[model samples]
Target: MNVSSPLNNEFAISRRRKAAMIVQMMISDGGNLSLSQLPESLQELLTDELGAIRLVDRDTVLGVAEEFIAELGSLGLSAPGSRDGAIAALSDHLSPTVAARLREQMESVRFGDHWHIVIDLPNSRIVDIMNAESVEICAVALSKLPTSKAAAVLAQTPGERARRITYAMSLTADISPDAVHRIGQSLAKEYGRPVSSAFDKAPAQRLGAILNSAVTQTREEVLGGLGEDDPEFANDLRKAIFTFKDIPARVKPTDIPNCIRTVDPAQLSSAIASALAADEPVISAAEFILSNVSQRMAGQIREEAEELGTIKKADAEAAMSSVTSAIRDLVESGTITLRDPEADTDE
Candidate 1:
């Protein structure tokens, strides 16, 4: 867990070659390598007298040297060794044009922060890193990462520890860039390789999906902890979760008939009646349910509901709750699927 020397050794030979090449380039150009002449990545690696050079293997010296030449050429100034000489020097190591194109491609490729490095790590290694840090620090670190990555890591962690980490993340409001960079550097040094991948779903939505599968007590505890740390964030997470009430708006109209058939007819009847009896009935919910059922079935349910008269508010709610819970279960079990309204509109 000690990250004193986390950099991968696999790139050591290449790094040394690049470092030596950079030194050669500087010497050839009459030691005129200026900070402004380097790519941001190379600039960050340089120090006074190159005292602390830590070349990232992601780029080669030839590549950076080409960029340096192009930058100088743009300023209408020749490189110290002459642009031709520098180009020849770079071409001696690698094709200058190809290297420059490769560098350009590298520049275009984006990698997420150090947290991404952690996610790319093996689960056992990720757990080890998490175990090495305090819950608060780990949570804050995880919170800064993409939600899918954070959730994947948390899901792999032990349940109790995961809960604590979730609580800590919710409480964390601000994390400095320095801290994140350091964490990422340490992780990259220890466990990462140069790689890139796309992110999916917002953190709230991903976390909501994970929580939806959780046991009620654990879900409540995590939400309660989140509520304590940041109520607004907790509210957002809650909204991300699709509940029974969300069905009217979220469920596909085509899927409704099958969903209705999954519930008990009597239970559906009582639930509909209770919904109708509410001071301001959820007309959308009633209509949605009725619209999905056959006309005869819908009519029969209406008659049965009328005979039932005014059921107790609690009874009505209980009946409705059961139907709602059933719908959620079906969705979770893949028996039904709800289309996201926002996603539809976006299309």
Candidate 2:
């Protein structure tokens, strides 16, 4: 297979340099080379080419290549057979003053590097780190973040866990910069870059979405707890958690059709029928669903509902639940966007 253009030049240069180094190493060491002593990448490449060649012959060649690559890396050099190595070679060739200037410029792009570190850390690992620390410490660290990043972290956490952390924050007063700085230093070490004060915020709808997927009991308990502690904040969480009933008010006319398209036709019909048949019918929801579809399709759905005559409340609820789940999935995947009334009207 042909290597991609981006890999070709660097791979060739690195491979040549490694091969030369391996030869020198082997000659110096009594012309002996061991395949097992070679780096795995070089070994794999050489092994692939050894299909027709004798194993012993190919092993010696690979052994040398691995030693060369390792030696180059040890000398603060990039592996000659990789893209990074090529970049390192170019940097090394530049004048010292020019290189120092470039390094300074690169350091200013720390945000990108910091982002990669955060992104590379798995959600579970982040949670583990938070859980391991004292609640006060965790809260202090979280509060130091800008709202968006804090929200993103909270969204990933289980509702109950997030509530505990939020509660801890409420109970605490001032957060010491020294404490935050120490934590920052540890995290910076892991990231291999200086810690910088920058973070990306998740959208409110996305946070709502994470809670939507949470267990109903956990969501309720957490919200109830938050309500007891801070009623207004709890109310905000309530507004964020959208349900099927919110479809009429939150979903835009343009997105309604696309949202319905994602739901099963049978489920949509059942959900609409059940809503219409209720003692206090969800007229708005029924209208929202019907208005979004073509007249012919709406008529057919109505006919189907009429033929069903009566649906048990349980069945209706189950059907509606399915349709709601489909809508949530669509929204989360960005197939559709739902407007948040409160967020839009907020000053």
Candidate 3:
């Protein structure tokens, strides 16, 4: 990566370049690493020298270098500059306060070569959309940006403005999947085919390209079949799938309690037992937990969870909700941990 960017203030480029140089030097040593391995004091001393050369605090420099090495290890290869740009781009996308601090410590920031502008103004006419307004009005008003400031700005516009842009986008010929596929086929036929390696990877966006396929059941069946075999493997495949436009209202309170009664008490007890083992002790861990929560609630959940072995439909859903919420709060507050490692393994 070129640490010297056209827009960076002075000293940033130099600092980043030094960091890169230090990383290069470390990798050049040709040493291997393992989980059990520990660096000697000599190696720690070497880090100080490298840190000075990189213009970073010793610990900061070593920590970053270690992370870099781990990443390289994952890929089982290294390519200088390929990762450099990504680092810089991520820095470029940080909030102003964070970016300023980072800029003070380094020379260059990374930025993407291109970006997209999605708009969704509902009432705006298809033909009346303006790109400048989309950029200025919508993009300029958002908070907590995850990417470049400019890109974040475009994401925060009012819903009406977004709808207008989306409406305009809808008028385009891109609506016809048939038209686009034919063109892709034509290009592929002409160019032959791309040579791909085992390392060939698809980005989330590329994986989302299946949204245009026309057959609803066909898509579901294909994806569902894969999910039946390995659910995690197909998780990303449904990233952009469409669903019903209307959402139903919530179930009644009585219905919720009935749902709670459906949980298996044995499963629930095992889960809670595990959670309690890892959990920090309150003045009286079990007592305190049961005190704030109703005994009847706990009883119902316990009964339902226990019935898992004998019956499939126990209707302990309401009780389960109470248990889940209580457990979540305790765990989040650091009051408890799952003592039973096997509890989560059951599901």
Candidate 4:
């Protein structure tokens, strides 16, 4: 038979029972515990032990808390048990933008680094950030971007300022990695700025897009009036417009195949015929489309147009509009990019 002395009886609590008593004692005294920080398995065990155990003496509860505190104090350091937990711990040490960026990039291999995230920013955003930030900051961001992206962004940046930023790049070879990372993180945050307006595109872009589907005469008439009254807006609208005549200058040769798929084969043939029968720029645009397509396909388009006989002026206008509409769709979806129109190119 086993005999228990009073001292043994007082100290007889099991580990789990002691843990429960300590937890209850802490709660009773108004201490808040973030029990959720523990590993889920341990949390479940603690919850179950806490619920199953009933009562403990005041001395036993006090002793358990002392032991728990002693053990915690004896540990030199404690690391967060998970990657997310570790990020949360150091989040206070970082700027909010960098910290949030770190959390987003933690699970993504695509970004690789902060500079790469900035590289992935649209060229327009990069230009905006360059315009808003100091010349030195712009120089750092421009240097960090890939050669191709940097060149494209610089093309859009103001000429004299871009030249200054470019020259500043020569001095950036000795910049510290930490400075570059912080600059990139700041730019990315800027890129993430919320749009205050409901519309996704600018007013001029919206007006031009609506005009794209309108008849050629309607587009010209509206622009003529806008030109007299609102020349600045008209100029912006002209830059945004993509007409059948603008095809050769704005659309790419390689993208011709995708446009062919976008419109019906018969419709594409009719548009080309319509353009061919029209004036200089329209004829060139027709030739651009036909030449870029396969030889067999080009031959077929000519054959189909011939079989359809002389297309009427109204029919031709409608057909050409269809082609332009398909190109506009491709541009909107980011599937194809338009070439920058030359200064002399008329809308």
Candidate 5:
């Protein structure tokens, strides 16, 4: 992505305009770019230049030119780094009034501890602020938000709550299409069954509608978890579930199995673990889960006995005995990790 040659496409035009605005504002600030505020690559390049501490105006200008070149390349702009030509072009494009307004905004701007913007604006405004790279102030201000306000922010967030806020909403949902598919893979691992991709079974129009309606935050969280565990299945699932909000609360039990059939048992277990782990002791709630199994499945319960070593052996045996059928079903389905000392030793 050469920054010097601005891609003439719509995306490029918009990005170039934004980039020019940022560059103009930065130069106006006595070229004093805070170390934390610079892009990662630019920071590294500047660090190298600052190391020699070269002070000559010509030398300094050359260094700045180098950075400009780097930025142009990275930004994929057609503008050259040579001061006389590209800089003049940039000057013409950025009006003094626009630059002054931006500078004024920058002056009043206060970055919090995280160095993000400190404003509570609308979501669209938040998105704009993110583009301005002024989100750090917001992160600092976020801690002051009341619990209810914080919750509302979180609900509106699309990815990791803290990250989204910190990154000024620039941080997209860590959840990707690949991650969603992986969740199904994980479920299959635990269940030893073929997990289904919802996209595969449903009509494209219906699936698209479901995804469009899904909760963004939920979809991202689920996709992230799935991606980390099951990349392939996550990709598959990405096609099946367009949005997390697609699933409704009033799902029929019969429909539940169809969804379950698409999920891998290990994935299910992981989801269960995650759900229980979040301020809830899932292990303590194991009994409720166990009650749903049958006698044949109960025989497989002994495999998990060893994994329960964290608990007393006697207690594990007692718990397994108490919910033998359910535990066995979990074991057979691969929902629980069976402690195999041999496997542990090899690892």
Candidate 6:
């Protein structure tokens, strides 16, 4: 009538048992380890091992730590653990076609079960699968997908399919890995879209981002030329480009406080002074920012900027660009929302 403890076991100390001990120790010590980055199978084993053992002797904890440290010291090199990672690291050395082929071959490797790939498919495609495939397969698919996306797909699915799929999910606890793997492979073959990770973003967005960093004169020249040759692309690129002048149009007034907080006081002053320095300056941008911030802060910044007097246009522009970059970061982080440009705005 004794419950076995993985950590307390003095004999047959497996690597997994030791790992669970270390992971538990780290968690107890408030370490924010990204255990999610580990392969799902490994995570499951770690979770199981951790669950089996309630407490560890200090000696076992110290032994595990010492062993882990020694093992780390002994490693001269570590290769990329997954084929995708390996392919990316070796891409410069490998032919593009070869690298792509290797990426496709990833299905037979760590993703051999193919559930990861299946779950990454578009939500609409998943809904279509639910419509066409058996209720059991749809249930298995939902179980494989991340909870939020699964919920969305289930909500979008027809009433009958959704009800059946939910019932099937309850019965999925005992499904065999081999059967799940087979289902995943079949689903992927039938429905998985070939995604090219060649570029993390669209071409227009990449080009626009490059222009964001370019000197204003150079950016304007390029945009002017592009406008003539490829009006459609140029129009799209213009939407992506958010410059100092675009602030008044694109950024929300309410976000100004949070946005400017990211900039240094001197940098903000310089940008303001320089913008106002021009013969026909960007008054709207300066006013937009000043109006949004507190009156005291606005007066202080204006006074400092005026005192600096005649900052080099280039220096001022650089500071302004820094402010714009901070704003972009806030937008990207979902901390602030930008007002839509003319293209998106209601008349």
Q: What is the C-alpha lDDT of each candidate?
A: 0.65, 0.63, 0.39, 0.80, 0.40, 0.83
Residue-level lDDT of model 6, residues 259-317, one tens digit each, is: 99979999999988887766443767888899999999999999999899988877988
lDDT of 6 at 279: 41
- Give the Å error, residue 313, model 6: 2.0
What is candidate 5's CA lDDT for residue 1?
A: 43
TM-score on alpha carbons, each prediction: 0.39, 0.40, 0.18, 0.46, 0.16, 0.46
Tens digits of per-residue lDDT, candidate 5, 162-190, equal 56576653443454545433432332222
Model 4, range 1-347, lDDT digits (tens) per residue? 54332222335767876777677778888999998666667888888877765545566556777888889899998888677677768877987667766666553322334676577778888888778888889999887778899889999999999988888888888989877767776676556433356798999999998998888889999999999999999999998999999988888788988986879777887888878788999999888988999999899898887777778888898899889888888888999989888646443
- In model 6, which runs have C-alpha deviations exceeding 4 angstroms? 1-192, 279-281, 343-347
Write one digit per residue (lDDT tens) for candidate 3, span 1-347: 63422322223335444444554555778745331222245456545545545234555555565666667688964433333434445655876556444533332221211111112212122112223344222222221123454243334535576556545543543335454333333322222222344544564324434532323446568677868986765675554332211000111122323322433555445433433332243113323333434678667545543444332222222322334444434434765442332234422
Name the Cα RMSD for model 4: 14.4
Tens digit of per-residue lDDT, candidate 1, span 40-123? 566556443244434434354446556556666889555644443354346447754564434323321223344554666766
Give the C-alpha miss distance for residue 287 in model 2, angstroms: 1.4
Q: Candidate 1, which segments miss by more than 4 Å at Cα?
A: 1-185, 189-232, 279-281, 344-347
Q: List runs of model 3 lying over 4 Å from the truth.
A: 1-97, 100-315, 339-347
Q: How would you encode candidate 2's per-residue C-alpha lDDT over 280-324 as one tens digit per residue? A: 436578877888888998899899888787788777877777777
Give me the displacement of residue 175 in model 4, in angstroms: 36
Instruction: Let me know the TM-score candidate 2 reaches against the reference structure.
Output: 0.40
